[model samples]
Target: MRKEKLKVLLVEDDRIEVLKLQRSIAKDLDNYELTLATNGKEAFERIEEDMPNLILLDLNMPDTNGIEFMQIMKGRDELLHIPVIILTTSNNERDIHECYKLGIAGYVIKPLKYEDYEAKIKAIFRYWSLNEFLNY
Candidate 1:
């Protein structure tokens, strides 16, 4: 049987961070598709069209924040099943707890160093690949 190529939707406003993540994912050259959304509103629009297998959301967007976005996602029957991972720079306890309450699959804090960020991205890939829920 052939494996399905995973599609990942990234919601982030930081250009530099986006570049870094793209580079890290490029290293593996795996069977994956990446889509970017500069803000929560754009993410929502894209989700409405066709939802990705997974979502990497940042907590502090300008138009709409990640938490608010998650709330809306939960309300939509079509989007509710897609797993959401909070990948952000925020380390606030309240934000973390709230994300869990909102049913985030994972919460990852952005690392300061490029190498660390790369490792984190790799780790995410590894984890998702091994996770039974993904049903590869």
Candidate 2:
């Protein structure tokens, strides 16, 4: 593994969900350097400031929701290439279709069980880290 941690920006509004992800990363993903943004508006600011290797986004937020954010990213040459994975609870067909249309890297439903959620998190980290997106 690389000594330097991978930058991972997570855009989520739910406080409880945020806490859950944080704990999972702290316990399992030492290779990632996680950053938090409550909404798409804040997400852009963080992206500009640091440039994460990967982004984990939630579909529902207070402002500038995930779809809107993806639309905006498509127009920006600098930000367009950053991979975004949807980590949301929504299973609506439209939401999935729209997200895939906007070119999300992956879509993962947030499992109801904490253990299941943690497993997904681990899998995400393992796959991404193995590819070593940060090396690019």
Candidate 3:
């Protein structure tokens, strides 16, 4: 049997961070289909249009942040099942604890080094690829 590409939606406000993620996973086309949403509002729109297999969210966005986004998802039946993994600069315990409370698959603190970030991204894909997911 052939493996399906993982459809991922990244929600972030920082243009640089978006670029970094793009660059990090640029070579994994066979394994991933990446989509971007600059903020929570756009993320919602994207999800409504094409639900992703996973969500890569940032904690500090304008208007609606990661935590708020998760809260909204928790309230919605259709959106609640998609896994969300936080990729952010925040290392605060409160942030980590809160994200877990809201049901996140993983929380990764963005490393200062690009190599480390890339490695983390690759590792994340490797880990998630082990699970079976429903195709949308």
Cα TM-score per model: 0.92, 0.94, 0.93
**Model 3, which residues run further than 4 Å from truth?**
134-136
What lDDT would candidate 1 get against the real structure?
A: 0.87
lDDT at residue 124 of model 1 (Cα atoms): 85
The lDDT for every candidate, in the order shown, is 0.87, 0.89, 0.89
Model 2: per-residue lDDT, tens digit, 42-83? 999999899998899999998898989899987899987788
Clashes of each: 0, 0, 0
Instruction: Kindly indicate the candidate among 1 and 3 with the higher TM-score.
Output: 3
Task: Write the residue-wise lDDT of candidate 3 on 21-99 in tens digits.
Answer: 8898888778888889988989999999888888999999998999999999889998888999999999999999999
Error of 3 at 65 (Å): 0.6
RMSD of every candidate to native, in Å, equals 1.7, 1.2, 1.5
By TM-score, rank the candidates, best first.
2, 3, 1
Candidate 2: clashing residue pairs, number: 0
